[model samples]
Target chain A: MTTHDLEYDNPNAIEAHNMSVYYGSFRAVKDVSLAIEKNRITALIGPSGCGKSTVLRSFNRMNDLVPSARVEGQVLFHGENIYAPGVDPVNVRRRIGMVFQKPNPFPKSIYENVIYGPRINGWKLSRREMDELVERSLRGAALWDEVKDKLNQNGLSLSGGQQQRLCIARALAVEPEVILMDEPCSALDPISTLKIEELMFELRQHYTIIIVTHNMQQASRASDYTAFFLMDSDRTGQLVEYGSTSQIFQNPKDERTEQYISGQFG
Target chain B: MAVTELRRQPSLLRAAFERFIQVLLVFAAAISILTTAGIVFSLVFETIAFFSEVSIVEFLTETEWTPLFSIKKYGIWPLVTATVLTSAIAMMVAVPLGLIAAIFLSEFASDNIRRTVKPLLEILAGIPTVVYGYFALTTITPFLKNFIPTLSIFNSLSAGLVMGVMLIPFVASLSEDALSAVPNSLREAAYGLGSTRFEVAVRVITPAAISGIVASIVLAFSRAIGETMIVAIAAGQNPRLTFDPTVPVMTMTSYIVQVSLGDTPYGSLSYYTLYAVGFTLFIFTFILNIFSYWMVRKFREVYD
Candidate 1:
């Protein structure tokens, strides 16, 4: 892949054009168009049900799980249309990893949970290689030092913070290009949330990340770019502003964004 | 201040009513326990009285079981063996079918399909066992006779087969509950990792709920062992130790029914045989119930 082929001028990892999501007859996200940069943390901050999480799920087609949900227009990843016919949703999901709001570890040992993604994808690594990968992934999530001696223990035996880190490691084990985190620190204490924010800074060097959060300070602290979404008069979510975090918080282009950051309204 | 002074006195009648309700609730719970204890105590005492006259060795070792004949040979093995054989066959049939149905309902069925199928399954459980006995005698026996020419009109094979069908809903309903109780997040986590739906169900959900599944199987086994009307009506009351389902074999339950219906002389060996058989059946089912309860209690749910 040459520099020209990769196109660093517009190094957009994800490009959404006129994408709208509907559940039954009610539209949740209306004509949202945004370009997420590669190798940067983009924070999606909005009030609850503002379609931030909905847009995050749309990236990996996770919304397909909802029986009544439907998506229109285009979502492109690496210049390829993810929702095109003949494109496998499973393959799309494998390339784009996700960590839910709550930590969800399988009812298995820590070792098993970390290796689950690679093992399912038929990555035939030797036992030693598998162990090294597990350790590497755990270290990448900033959890290896805490759980090095208890790899054989059940994943559920860990504290809430440790479990969330384990889930991050699980997502990392697959070697995905992009990671989507839906309020990954919402359930954690302030100290653990700080730790996760630091981990996210470290992770941005290798993988493009999109995080949905309600905490404005977290978005300002950890993200390079921020997208502000707001509910319209009709109760549907619409993007208000998208720019560098410094610009969005310090000098917002939209008045709605200013009011939102100034705590006048959601 | 004046209104508060007037309301300061608590109503004695209201307090007494609350106390009365609490006492009644406690009394109801105690009655449940007392009823179980009474039945167990009566069964034990009567069983002891029966065992005094008949040697334990004779009851256990003898193969021929003819309590009413002029030359009585009282051996419980033939009846016990019959019960085991039929239950084993019934379990072999029920476990696989029930588990598959449960997996389908819990994992694969659409919401609409499940709504229709689950109640239809429970209807099978709701059917009276006597109706199953009649169905076995009339339909299943004749059906089996077409394949196996040697099948007796009243044989353990047909009875056990129909009994297995009757037990299907019991196993399926409980196993479905176990499978449904497995958190949706677990399945989503597996899917997010690129696991196929089958892989998630087989690898994650099944193992997560293994204890509950095992408990359901054990409970179904107990139901099969304790079933009476199906075997009594379809399986002839002749206690003979034979593996061939073509021949008439008597179960412990069937023998109890036979002896009770015949009006055997009071205080005679035949009269005492009922208690002996009842005791053995009780012990067998009690052990199974305990094992099932233990397996369910031992299960640990994973939540993060």
Candidate 2:
């Protein structure tokens, strides 16, 4: 009954199978399933509080930090159930990184911020190796040139967009297989948002990217395919449409999808 | 309406009333400054008088502190050493336990458990210091005496331990506030990087909250150094020149109290010694406060 029920071929990076997320007793995200293709950008576009962020967080088991949050079904990564017993959420997160809505750089030096993940994972590197990793990660996020001279400066001292990129660089240092961005550019200016969009396209060659955004234009422009989420009768997020960006934006199968894409109602 | 309001000048009475309110507020703010100035002036004046009789060199370098007894050796080291020893012990107890308790309360405990437990922890700080003094004197010293044969009835160990107990809730409560003030986004970033709970709390959150935590510890240490009741009740009256916590030792506060309780003639050298010691205590605590301020100013990483 839901678009989330649709299936994809093999070689998918992440697969949420009949997953439902609940906050306390309320079903915040209804029974919905979706397959995220490998090395492709999948944008979850929806209105405010449509559970896009919630469903995205469930993939890496970040929702486990919430005491009352419970997942009813499975989130599979590379054919292994992430939510299954004895599968550590910490290990799950090691394979899948996340970026937040706002620019949340740790109040540390730029150099320290990038190395924090690698250090905790017990990767002992030489001074030269560390410098290279920092450079590579910063370059990966397209932030190396702006911040090369002062690696010792606080990460929070950067501009809003640069801080977000530093967060992206920090995530990249961990070298996760999939990167989940929860409205990464919502707080950014248009130019910075474009920069992040461009960076996403570049990042798609290496990591599987899943982003939740409210901007219709951003979804169509930045993603290869988009999943449109809307509230159901019970006010829980239900997938209404799923297709390629050009197909959903140009021609829609459902009236609701048409109304949403045409800017009638979000 | 804006032009009319801008064009009009205040009436004489209204202007005078505003001036009066401003002066009143300024006077209210100046009360603290005036009090500090008064205390400083009085302490310095008497400390100079005490120096007239007892040399500054002897006060700093001499090991004896028998101003009340027959020997009358005026070295200030015994009192200073005793105060430092007790405060060090207090810090040793308060730092690890209080910080762990804070981390537990902020990062580990659930909402229900936190709601039920944090208030109970704070209640420990609310208990009067006099009761702690008695608890140290009547109960703790006796319990400790069973283990250590050389433990005196009035020893620094019991007093310092009880002082640490009293300061536990202080350090824990303040540090919990600092640790929790770290934005959840930072924790998320760490978690997203595959950091375990312990790693996130220790490596990420602790470093972020370091300034505030150090501030709490320094403030608690200042409180410990200035504490009187527990030291006076349990840590004996004689100022001795040894680092041994088992033996009875006197602190600067205890000396001041001992002198103030008995009859010391006004305008005498004995009376001036009180101010001298009080001034020394004041200087130590002032340095600690300044250090705390500098640490917070220099190292604080502001997260918005």
Q: Rate the local accuracy (lDDT) of all candidates.
A: 0.90, 0.92
Model 2 chain A: lowest-lDDT 10 consecutive positions: A1-10
Worst 10 residues of 1 chain A by lDDT: A1-10
The B-chain TM-score of model 2 reads 0.96
Q: Summarize candidate 1's per-residue lDDT along B214-252 as a digit string, tens digits.
A: 998999898888999999999888899988787889999
DockQ for each model: 0.71, 0.79
Runs with alpha carbons beyond 4 Å of true place in candidate 1 = A1-10, B2-9, B302-304
Model 1 steric clash pairs: none
C-alpha lDDT (0 to 100) for residue A106 of candidate 1: 88
CAPRI docking class of candidate 2: medium
Clashes of 2: 0
Best by DockQ: 2
What's each prediction's TM-score?
A: 0.94, 0.94
The DockQ assigned to candidate 1 is 0.71
